[model samples]
Target: MLVALAIRDVVLIERLDLVFGPGLSVLTGETGAGKSILLDSLGLALGVRAESGLVRAGQSQASVTAAFQPPPAHPTYALLLEHGLEAEEEIVLRRVVQADGRSRAFVNDQPVGVSLLRRLGALLVEVQGQHDQVGLADPASHAGLLDAFGGFEADRAAVALAHRDWRAAERALEAARAAIAEAQRDEDWLRHAVGELGTLAPEEGEEEALAERRQGLQQGEKRAEAVAGALSELTPRDRRGGGNPAAALRNAARALERMPPPNDSIQPALILLGTAQDALAEAETLLARLVQEAAPDPRALESTEERLFALRAAARKHAVAVTSLPELLERLKERLSALDAGSGQVVALEAAARAGRAAYVAAAGRLTERRAAAGASLDAALSAELVPLKLDRARVTVALTPRPEAAWGPDGQDRVEFLVSTNPGQTPGPLARIASGGELSRLMLALKVVLARGSPVPTLVFDEVDSGIGGATAAAVGERLAAVAARVQVLVVTHSPQVAARGAQHYQVAKSVTGERAETSVTALLPAARREEIARMLAGERVTDAARAAADELLAALT
Candidate 1:
């Protein structure tokens, strides 16, 4: 419930502090006396758009602060908990608007976005003025209202869970289908690539080994040709002077042995000839080994080239390197497996979706039954209150229409609308469409009285809701508002004496002059002052004895 409001430097309102309690409170004043200003200030504190023009004529800024005491289950508590603020303590909302049209909001003195403050404010207080009832007019609020009235909170929870489950199953089904389709699109390419890679059978470092072997063979081919040319040049036929390198080296070594080692020149020549013979023998052995090993077949070389080119082509096709062929093959195998396994996954998802649908149907069916019963009960209760509020001919109907597709909401599969038929032979339409603003306000008052018995909001503010009502009906409206106040805090702005007289707390809003400056102020009325204010409301500027007597009677009746 809203407990306090403080305004400073606001238009017409210089500085005011008003404390409210848990009962119907009235703010009564003559026209143009800033009654609406007070409410607008409260609205600004409640996160309404701030206008720079609303600042006091000479001030740089305007501010309003509202204090509320909401229960643990109230919406403000949840929001505070979400923001990691203290939820159990009192909630203080402050709004400051600068003359430049910029504004700042604070919750519990912690700066927050205007949207956040507005959301928390909604949970704390509901200002039921002319333009503030769009939520009530919304179709979504109907099922929620019904749920609150029918005690279907548990059913609503179940429906929400079922909807979540259905979405989960739907997501699973969609994933499986997408996976299978993607795998199918690439299956043929995968198979062909895998087959080609298996045939080629490339290994790590294969490229280096093949290139080294080709180089070795090419060198061998050149050396073998040189050896054959040397062997042919050393032919044993009569045309050559030396039959072979080995024969020449052998003759030289024999001649060197015949010479004695004592003569210095002959000994040196003998030693060189022996060394030459040894070297020639080594060369012949090397040439023989090369001839035996250099059997490099062209077919083998061509095979190597073909395999390397195929690996490269495959790598390019898959946008990877030859070294990654093995990994790509593995991926291909996995994708095929996923395509095969996806069929069974789709079946499982379908079953899960069916189960979720069944659960939703059961929960929605139960909630619908309860809503129907609640509608009848609410109709009976509100119907009884209607006649006394001068709406005797208007029938308030709580209409619940089922839409299975729409039923997929957190509340369930139904759209609830509050309809009214003012008289006989009139088809019921939406209350806002059928009734004028004044009539709707009266009806809303009746509804407030009815719903206040079980309200989630902690505070209710009605601005000029009693505008078109007077005499007995105005008194009745006050009586009903007071009845609602017994449950939650009620704040009303009225010009009617009967309503003001019925307030447990009466406040007089008036324009006053202080220090040669005009200002608007509000003061809680004392017993003697309240009587005079009520009399003023009755007789305007002329407070006669009869108006005072009428005020006394109204106060007496309220007591």
Candidate 2:
């Protein structure tokens, strides 16, 4: 419920702070006493569009704040949590509007967008008047209201879940169908490619390995020619004759040894010749080993080149690297396997989708049945309230029509609307169209009385709903407001003393002039002050003895 409202520099309201409590509270005063200003100020704080004219004369800005203490399960609390905002025991909504028409909004002291504040405001309080454009005035909320009244939350949830399952199954089936169609379109080409790839059987890194082996073989062939030439020169067929360096060196050493008996130079020459012969023998043995080691196998080289070329050509044809060939082959095999199993998979998915649709249809059908019963009960309850409000010849109807399949939703297939007829032999139409301002207000009141238990809003404000009616009808309106207030907080701006007398608390709005400026003030009236005010409302500018006595009688009867 709204706990307090504060206004500063808003039109005639220079500065006003009013604390509120639960139950019926009435704001009453003479006409032009700024009663509407109070409601407008509350609207500003609730995120209505701000106007520059709302700022008081010579003031640069205006501000309004509304504080609410709603229950923990209130939707506003959930909204705050969703926005990552703080949800304390008391929720304060503040709006500041500058004379330039710029505005800012805050929730719980945290800056927020006007849209979010408006959303939260709608959940916290509902302001109903002849010109109200929010809440039940919008036909879109009718279905939700009916569900709330019918206690169909569980049924609605079941339908929503079934709808989700149906959509998911349908999506899966569509994807499968598309995949199978594409696979069938390319069946022949895919089979041929798969056969060719399977024959080639490409291996990872085989290209690089084969290229390296081929390079080594080509290099070996070049080196083998030089090694063979060196071996032939070093080791002649007849080592004793041509290219016989070892024989020649040994003969020289023998000659030197024989010619010089004890000469030092001749003995040194023989030792050098012996060393040369030993070196020649070692060179022949090393050269023979080089020839054997450098020999290349022609067949192995040919095979390596063939495999490397084959991998490169296949990689180009497939538009992939040689290393990716293995992965591509695996994927193609899987696709082919899926194609072979596509018919059975498609059949199974279709069956699942059908089951999902059947579940949704069943749930929606049950919800529709319940709504039909609840609508009838609601119509009866509202019809009972009409006669007391002086609409004896009028009737309210809850219309439930089946929507087309294209318009079906998670909430179910029924479109709910509240229709009314104000006189006999008149066709019933939408409530907004059939009722005048006074009639609409009474109809709304009756509907609210019927729906009070299901409404989530903690506060309901009626803006002079008793505009053109009085006497017993005014008293009846007061009684229904009291009934609604028993369940939720109600604030009414009224000229009816009977309505004012029914208030659990009464506030009188009065305009005052200070210096050259006019300002509005609100006073919470005690029992005596309340009686005087109600007497004034009854007597109109003169509180007669009979009016005061009547006021007393009204208050006493309320007790």
Candidate 3:
């Protein structure tokens, strides 16, 4: 609940501090007694737009501070926690407006932006006026209000969860469909590439091995020519059939052995001839082995060269290194496999999406049914309140219309609106259009009375909600305000003595001139002082004996 309001150099309120208590409190004074200024100051503290003109004539700045003590469950606590600010037992919101029209805001003495202050203010208090610019007047908030009144938070949450799940499933289905479409677009190319790569079957480092083998074969061909020429020289096919140097050397040694006598020279010559024959035979054998080993088959050399060139051509065609061809092959094969299985995968995704949608529809259907029932009950309750507020002819209706699929959301499929009919046999219309200003205030009051139990705001301020009505109608308004105050703190700025008399606390706003400066002050009236103020309201400029007697009667009736 709002505990206090302090104003400094704001308009006519030069300096004032007013402490507020729970229950209905009425602020009463003559016209232009700065009641509006008081509300303006409160609005400033609540983060309303600040103006330089609000500063007093001799002051450089204007400031307003509002103090509140809200319960733990109030939304302000959550807002405080969200901003990384401590939620103390008491919360203070202050706004300062400079002479240059600049302003600053603070919550619990921690500097904050005006936007945050306004947000927190909305959750802490709801200011309703005859114009109905805030709170229930907004059509966007109607659904949330209906849900709160209907106690359908859990049902609504369930529907929200289901909606999220349905959306996620839809996204998954879309992604899978896109993947399959892309794969299908390239299906033929993928299959052909896979087939080509499979046939080639290139391995890592196979290029190097093939190149080495080809080089060895080319070198062997050259070496074989050289070895054949050398062997021909040693053992040429000439006129003497397959004669070699070893045969010639052996003939020489035999001739030497036959002609040798006991001469030393002849003996040495025989020995030399024998040694040359042995050396020539060894050379001939070695040459034959070399020629045989150097010979390479032309078919094998052609095959190795072809394999090496094919590997290089495939690598260039695929825009990959020879070593990476195997990996690329595996990847293409995987895409092909996925394409083959895509139909089944798409079917599974579609089924999941369908299940998700079904679950959401079921949850929303149940919630809509319960909301309709609750709306009916709320309408009946609000209608019961209308008769006493002098709107016995007015009827309230909760309109629940199914939203189109395109407009459906987490809140469910129904759009809730509060409709009203002021006279019998007339079609009900929206609340803002169906009633006069006074009637609308009363209607809002009736709704508040019925819906107060679900309201999270700790304070409600009604500015002249009793405008242009008096007598029993004003009394009815007072009664309703009192009833609402029983549940939460209510501050009403009014001129109706009956409404003022109904207050658990009464305050008188008065203006005075001091040293060429005008100032507005708020005084919490004692019982006797309250009677005089109420009498003043009843009697106008002059307080009459009869008016005093009526005020006393009014006070006595409350007991």
Candidate 4:
């Protein structure tokens, strides 16, 4: 509820402060008394569009602040939290408009964008009037209001849950389809590559092992070749060649034996040659053993080279290191396996999605039925309120239109609008479009009286709801306003004495001229002052004795 309002340099209102309480409060004054200026000031504080002309003369700027004390669970607090603003026991919304028409907004003294302030203001208070019916005028709020009145929380929750499930299932199906499509595009390539890799069957660390073995074999081959060359030179293939030292020594000994016996010099030469021949044979044997021990298997080296080359070629073809080939092979195999299974997976997910959508449709269908029933009840309730408010020819309807399938949402796929026809045989139209100023205000009052229990805003301000009506009709408007105020705070600007008399709290708006400057002032009326003010409203500029008696009777009836 709005707790207080402070205005400074706003049109005729200069430095005015007024405190308010919860209940039906009426502001009454004569024509040209600046009553509308108070509502304008309040609208400025609520983040309405500001005009330079609203600033007082000779003032550079005008500022208005409105304080509200909503409950902890109020949606305004939630909105503040969403905007990274903090609110304690009180939420103060302040707006300042420059003489150039520029404006700034603040909430709880924290600077904020005017849009956010406007949204918060909407959640805090709803202003219904001849031309400023905030919540009622907007068709977007109709569905929510209907849902609130219908009390379809459980059904709405079911629909929301089903919607989430359906969307999840759809997403899962899409992912599976994409995966299968990509795999199918690569199916032939994958199969051929898998076959090629399976044939190669590369192992981790096989390259390094083959390389080490090749190096050892290469060193052995070199040593064996060097040994074979040395052995061939030491023992030629032909025995007749003089290069064979052992053969030459044996022939020399045979020649020496043929010489005359007892030739000691030749005998010494033979002995020495025999010793040389023995050493030569022993060296040949040693060389043969060394060749046998160092010789490498050429077939084994060739096989190793072939295997290593095959592995490296496969690595290059696959664009991966030899060590990673094993993991890559496994991954490709898994993808191929998934390709074989993806069709069934897609079918299952499609079924799940269909089931989910079916569930949502069922829940939403139930919610629609309930809302229709509630709409009928609402139409009846508002009908009861219209006649006494002097709208006997008016007909109100709760129109529910089916939304397109593509536009379905968790709120259950129906568009709710309040339509009104002010006269018989006239097609019902939107409340704002069909009703005139006075008719619209009274219609809004009737609707509000019915929707008070479901309204989220804590305060409702009506500007001249008693316009174009008097006597019992004005009294009826006041009674309805009081009934609504019982559920939420209400403030009505009125000139009807019947409406003014119904207020639990009254304020008189009067303009005073001081030193060529006219300023608006608001004063909270005590019991005596309130009686005089209502009497003045009844008598118009003069409070006659009869008007005073009528005011007393009006006040006496309240007790």
Q: Per-residue alpha-carbon lDDT of model 4 for 1-559, expressed as tens digits?
A: 9999999999998799999999999998878899889988888888788899999999999999999999769888778888888857899999999999999999989999999988888888898888777778788888778888888778888888988888899899999899888889999998888888888887888889999999999988988999898888777567567577667778888998899867877877889889988988898899999999887877999999999998888889889998888888888887788799998898999999999899989988998999999999998988889999999899999999999988888888798899999999999999889999889999999988887776789999999988889999999998999899899999999978888888889999988899999988899999999989888888877789999999999989975
Give all TM-scores, in the order shown.
0.74, 0.79, 0.71, 0.75
Q: Alpha carbon lDDT of residue 250, candidate 2?
A: 72
What lDDT tens digits, residue by residue, belong to model 1 across residues 229-321? 665554454545456766786787687677765656777776887788787777766666766666457676677667667778888988998
Highest TM-score model number: 2
What is the C-alpha lDDT profile of model 3 across 492-515, one tens digit per residue?
999898899889899999988888
| Alpha-carbon shift of residue 224 in model 4 (angstroms) | 25
In order, what lDDT does every prediction score?
A: 0.81, 0.88, 0.88, 0.89
- Comparing 1 with 2 on lDDT, the higher-scoring candidate is 2
Q: Residue 454 of model 3: what lDDT?
A: 67
Rank candidates by TM-score, best first. 2, 4, 1, 3
TM-score of 4: 0.75
Which pairs clash inside model 2? none
Candidate 1 has a TM-score of 0.74
